[model samples]
Target: MKVIGKHLTVDMYGCSFDSLDNLEFIKTAMLEAVKEANMTLLNLSYHKFEPQGLTALALLAESHMSIHTYPELGYAAVDVFTCGDQSRPDKALAVLKSFLKPEKTKTTNIMRGDFGSQKDMKPRIKISIAPLRRVRNTSARVWSLLRKK
Candidate 1:
């Protein structure tokens, strides 16, 4: 079996845009981003939210690219995620920022998937998480209460 995986995280802020109500413009931009990422697009869905703004999504074979626009506030939220090639998402994100003209942008990257990535991946028949602890001790309960806050 073979495994392939890549992870990327990008945070962008203070984006400047000409207008949010323009469906054609934003839709074009979204399509460009998907193509630039080298991902095959299966479908694209977009609509104007009205009063507030518009939300758009590009569904791709790798994953998805989405954006929310707030023209009134001169802001937008963008996300590009893929699993095959590591730099593809970031490259797409760069293209998006360049066109969107965001004032501020931050990015963090991390590997996604198991040790072998998607290779030999299978759904877990059983799930195991944190062991349930017996809550009889007063001090333990008090500690748990404090942690929750």
Candidate 2:
């Protein structure tokens, strides 16, 4: 099997209900998770439900990560799909699990970009991650303020 990427699908149960409903916390936690995974954050967007729950998506240079919350059930589903070895999906999952404090976590790892025929050609490249201090602050503020409305 030819593998070009790693994808992690995580199911977190028994998390803090209140935290899942907080958009600001979710965005910050997600950004922190991406940083912890050593992934490059390209962009991030999040939306809050009518009364409760939230969904956040982080676009990364490696790939993408998404966190969908079901506050009423105290559950969240997170996906961390990254190409290349530079990104650490496990580290990202650890950070998210720590923040959510889930009693039970189920994770599945999948190999992506598998080509049946081209097994010999392995393409690789190195990338530099830009500083996110300014972008992070601005995004967090916007998400937070929007949630309050």
Candidate 3:
């Protein structure tokens, strides 16, 4: 099958609840996971919720990864999606699981944008163009182009 990307969704149970609540720890784990997967990180954002929860997102050149932790429940939901064949989402998950030390974990691997079955079919991309007006600002023209999408 022709696949564009791989997505691994993980449900970690019986993990270290305290570590899950630490934003810095979570960030470190995520970065280490991304590196283990051989994916390039474009940016990252993480937030610690009130009472006890944390959510961290990492934007990657191949795709993205995210981890949402429920410390009170000792569970964390993690997702790793990568478009590059060299980027191993499984390896990333392994790294994360090591850090979380979950006693029980469930994971699902999904193949995204598979198109090989339709051998005779070609994807059609449609784009409509409009006459450009007198736009002096460079940024305005870029915005206008993006608005078409």
Candidate 4:
């Protein structure tokens, strides 16, 4: 598996907060994200057990996009996990960030698979990262590597 991920400091403005309280907005946003990511939407699972929090997950063929909200703190956590065709996650993330607007964000790159100790049977990585080619500091890379492992 080839994976490139970004944790974005999205700009979560009043719009994000408004969306959290409205079911229609959340559904629309999630559906739009699915289409933008070019992923098939299998289903959606929403949880509102906690009045102050809301969790919405969009199940996609590529992977998943999840959002957790903290209405009290006026904050939210978003995750886009795509395995094959790494561009999907970045694209989806970009849309999400643009709409949500997080203040602080960080992305980590992960190369899964290719555990080939021998000359043969090289593992195939499914991700392609041409879309997420951004300059990042070496220290950030090290931190992400350590955390991912």
Best by TM-score: 3
- Model 4: lDDT equals 0.64
User: Tens-digit lDDT track for model 1 on 1-149?
Assistant: 33344545555566554555577878887777777777788899988875657888888788877888888777777777676653388677777777777777667554455666553354447654434344446669899999999
Candidate closer to the true structure by TM-score (higher is better), 1 or 4: 1
Please give the CA lDDT of all the candidate structures.
Answer: 0.70, 0.90, 0.89, 0.64
lDDT of 2 by residue, 1-149 (tens): 55888889999999988989999999989989998899999999888997899999999999999999999999999999999888899999999988999999999877787875454345546554455776888899999999999
lDDT tens digits, residue span 35-88, model 3: 999999999988889999999999999999999999999999999999968898
Query: What's the CA RMSD for each of the models?
Result: 8.9, 19.8, 15.8, 13.4
What order do you get sorting by TM-score, best first?
3, 2, 1, 4
**What TM-score would every model get versus the actual structure?**
0.64, 0.76, 0.76, 0.60
Candidate 2 off by > 4 Å: 117-149
Kindly report which residue pairs in candidate 2 clash with one another.
none
- Winner by lDDT between candidate 4 and candidate 1: 1
Q: Backbone clashes in each candidate structure, one number apiece?
A: 1, 0, 0, 14
